[model samples]
Target: MYEADQPGHGLDAIVAQRTPRGGAAQHGISKKYAMHHRSGPSLWLWHMRRGDFDAAWTVSDVVLEARRGTACPHLPRHEQWVWDGTPLAGRRVLVRCYHGLGDTLQFIRYAPLVKAVAREVIVWAQPKLIPLLRTVRGIDRLMPLHDGAPDAEYDVDVELMELPHVFRTTLRDLPREVPYIHAKPLAAFTSPIKRRYGRLHVGIAWRSGDWDARRSIPFALMARIAEIPGIVLHILQFGSGLEELPDGFGVLHDVSDISKMAAVVRALDLVVTVDSMPAHLAGALGTPVWTLLHMEPDWRWMAGREDSPWYPTMRLFRQERQGEWGPVVERVSVELIRLLSREAPQCASGRSGD
Candidate 1:
């Protein structure tokens, strides 16, 4: 996908090769798996679609080892061997966030778990995300990833996404504990400009990062869900898809900043978003969130599922057909109606008090 002028049907071959029953047997090349991050998170995506997480380590490790051949300044020519999954009690440890913001949000839950055993845990992350991640439970230090690793001597280091594999996790062993992350809301966004117009305040995100369109929801389709009764919908999206929004809908402006976005999510009665960062943020905060997914969604959501093991607060609403969100949105609207009905009296009582 990185190559714009790539060969014909390149993706079909890539997807087919990595599919569960595909020829990429033994989890690697020619009947065995190779530890290469070069494939990016696609390895995770592959196994995740099949609900197989045990191989996550193998994929991530391949990438870590492959770093030796790259020009990455931080991954100099082998000063120290990569840290195998060992007890970190007295050893200095480093953890780098090498993926997207959403992956980082999902995996950072492991940092506190990592910190429990490690003597010290230093996180090297995207410069912009540092401020947001600083408050997470187990991190002793947080720094932005510059050209190279920071000037610090460390006994061992690991990538953030690799922690799950290091721990040998299974679906049964997922850290379903919500509220692992601690975020501070911007004081500036203390109140919404518009007063309550519905019984339930719902925050919605229909677009993802500027990468692929596979996971995004068209504003036109998403707007239909806003038509549901007793629900106030606020857009939690930013970037290119902004122009497509329906009139009178407010864009979730402060949401572009993860921390402030978190604060906003924390305040919502419920979050209805596509498979994006806001869903992860809402889940991490233990807020009630309904994740509207694409027909063929990411591996994290898994296949044929309505709930996520990663976040107890999250409920999945998947598209019934490819490139079509109407059914999904309609189903969500029905559920929303049912949910708001149950809360009608409570909403009425709260309004009376107000």
Candidate 2:
């Protein structure tokens, strides 16, 4: 007896469970399909990493279909999977944000698309993001996610990550539009910063969340960037890495308020960050951003692509080898110099100073 709530049931039990007599349409997909994709999650990631979205969606359908009626009430929202090939034609869709801040930022672009068809679009997002997400177009209402039941009623539910699959998105048709979420420029940050007109005000964030330390570059290594001329660095990193910043490297800004953070990011001329929330935020706001990636980054970054299809203004700097920041930093330095050399006159004349 395999139980959906059992902590250690694993994939073997997932496929081995006897299907309800009603069969595939009853939400139990074919056993042969399940057996072939023994590692469904890994296979899905592998397909996505290789940019085979059609194949990835096929794997997603089978995986999601297999668990259509299953229940795991004890799991946290972030761990619980939602959406089961449900159509959103005329339903009240509850778009749940059961993931990290960065994940929410990246996928919120799909809200307009969802609103195009659904009767009502309700976003249950992380509390910190509510102020910022309020500015995004097409959301009928916004609710801050909490420990209790959701505040709104909906005909169907889907996790924010599932939006891409729901739309059957491909690299060619990915929602690549910039500035989907708008943030007013912070008067405090904008007025003072504009006074310094000649140097480019480049915001830099070198750390990522602790779940994956590999995604972050050491604060000391950021010296390579600090040495670059004609660019004034503003430190966008918050939490643990601030202590590691050497004296006079950059001006550290408070990122406690996400809305203010968005305003600061929008005010900057360019953002250079690791694969973190800032990267997603900058990309979402349509600001020019350079994302430094680990050798094997998350599947979203995909494999061997310098520019992201999801963000037209983003440029990627990938590690040729795992755990080596030297080459990645060197390449960024060269590019920074070239960019400054080309944009010098405009940067000097422009108000934001980039």
- Against the true structure, whose TM-score is highest? 2
**TM of each candidate vs. truth:** 0.77, 0.89
Q: Which candidate is the best by lDDT?
A: 2
Q: What lDDT tens digits, residue by residue, belong to model 1 across residues 270-332?
A: 789887778888888788899988777656678888999999989998878888888888898
Report the poorest 10 consecutive residues by lDDT, candidate 2.
Answer: 1-10
C-alpha lDDT score of every prediction, in listed order: 0.67, 0.78
For model 2, what is the error of residue 345's alpha carbon versus the real structure, in angstroms, after optimal superposition? 1.7
Tens-digit lDDT track of model 2 for 99-199: 77887888899999999999999999888889889888889999988777898889999888778888989988899898888887777887666667767
Candidate 1 wrongly placed segments (more than 4 Å):
1-47, 55-89, 184-198, 345-354
**On a 0 to 1 TM-score scale, where does candidate 2 land against the true structure?**
0.89
